[model samples]
Target: MIRPATPNDAPAAIQLLFLAMEDIARKISGTNDMQVVTHIFEHLFREPGNQYSFENTLLYDAGNGVAGMIVGYDGGKLHQLRKPVLDYIRWQTGAGVCPEDETQAGEFYLDSIAVAPGNQGKGIGGQLIDAAVARAAGEGMRKAGLLVSTDNPAAQRLYERMGFKVEYTMPFAGGRYHHLIKKIDNA
Candidate 1:
């Protein structure tokens, strides 16, 4: 059952996100940096007016845990290609980097879609995507997009099966990343 996330669900949401990120890191770089991952997750809940939103849906396990998550937002103005280059070198020269050809206007970003490890292979991911699509349509968004790490083939396959196409691929942070876009009718 998908429902809106409230402020109380912040801890569970962060846990689900961490699980998903661990899976991604293991699949991509073959490393599990829990410290950095935890910091990022903590920062999201700590920061005020963060870019990402988690009120769309939060998958309950029906027992005592969260099985997955589907997070998206009206990311029409968040995609800037030169954000990394300028924000990094100018401010923090040795800071972390992201995809170089960032987002452009009119793109609603599907920031993250993750399912728990134990609950995977059971069509939960598909359901999350469907929920996100429905929400995007309801919000009258123009196009939905996301950045998938090129090393994560499982996620890439899942996104492709859900009508997301690879608009372009580029190198970033010593690795490859794919910018996937899905055009949806905002009518």
Candidate 2:
């Protein structure tokens, strides 16, 4: 079952968060240390209105436990939602950065998605993505967008099968990525 995540879910969701962010988590956190990154994001996870807040996340519970998670929100609200994250990073590490915008107005952006290590290969991820796209359409967005690294053909193929087409290429999170978009027909 996929449901809206809450602050209470942060502890269990921390690893999933790291899974989604991967190395970009290090870049944004300004530390190569997973412990520091986990601490900082756990703090943000408990907060509201930040990009990493539970307010924008959905958790896939596989009866026994959380199997996956997805974080998405209006692309137009990127700057507003991201401010707190950047501020926290600066405060924690004394590094200030404004990475290239990964999303923009007129779409709902899937900022991150991850399947738990133990639950992967069971199709939970595709289900989570479908749920997120439906959520976006329900919220009146005309498009849903996400980024896949150009180097990951397997992931690119997966997104393509899910109907997300490459709109263009862009540099994001210190890597070249293909920005993909899927039309929200019902919206």
Judging by TM-score against the true structure, name the best candidate.
Answer: 2
lDDT for 86 (candidate 1): 32
Per residue, candidate 2 scores C-alpha lDDT tens digits across 65-94 of 888999999999999999999999899987
Per-model lDDT: 0.62, 0.90
Q: What is the C-alpha RMSD of each candidate to the true structure, in Å?
A: 5.1, 1.1
Query: Per-residue alpha-carbon lDDT of model 1 for 1-187, expressed as tens digits?
Result: 6666665566677777766555543322223566544444444444334443344344545356678786676665454322432343235223433434346566666666777778889888788777777777777876788878988998898889888999999764456889998878653
Span of ten consecutive residues with least summed lDDT in model 1: 81-90
Tell me the lDDT of model 1 at 71. Answer: 65
What are the clash counts of all predictions, listed in order? 2, 0
Which segments of model 2 are wrong by more than 4 Å? none
Please report the TM-score between candidate 1 and the true structure: 0.71
Top candidate by lDDT:
2
Error of 1 at 156 (Å): 1.4
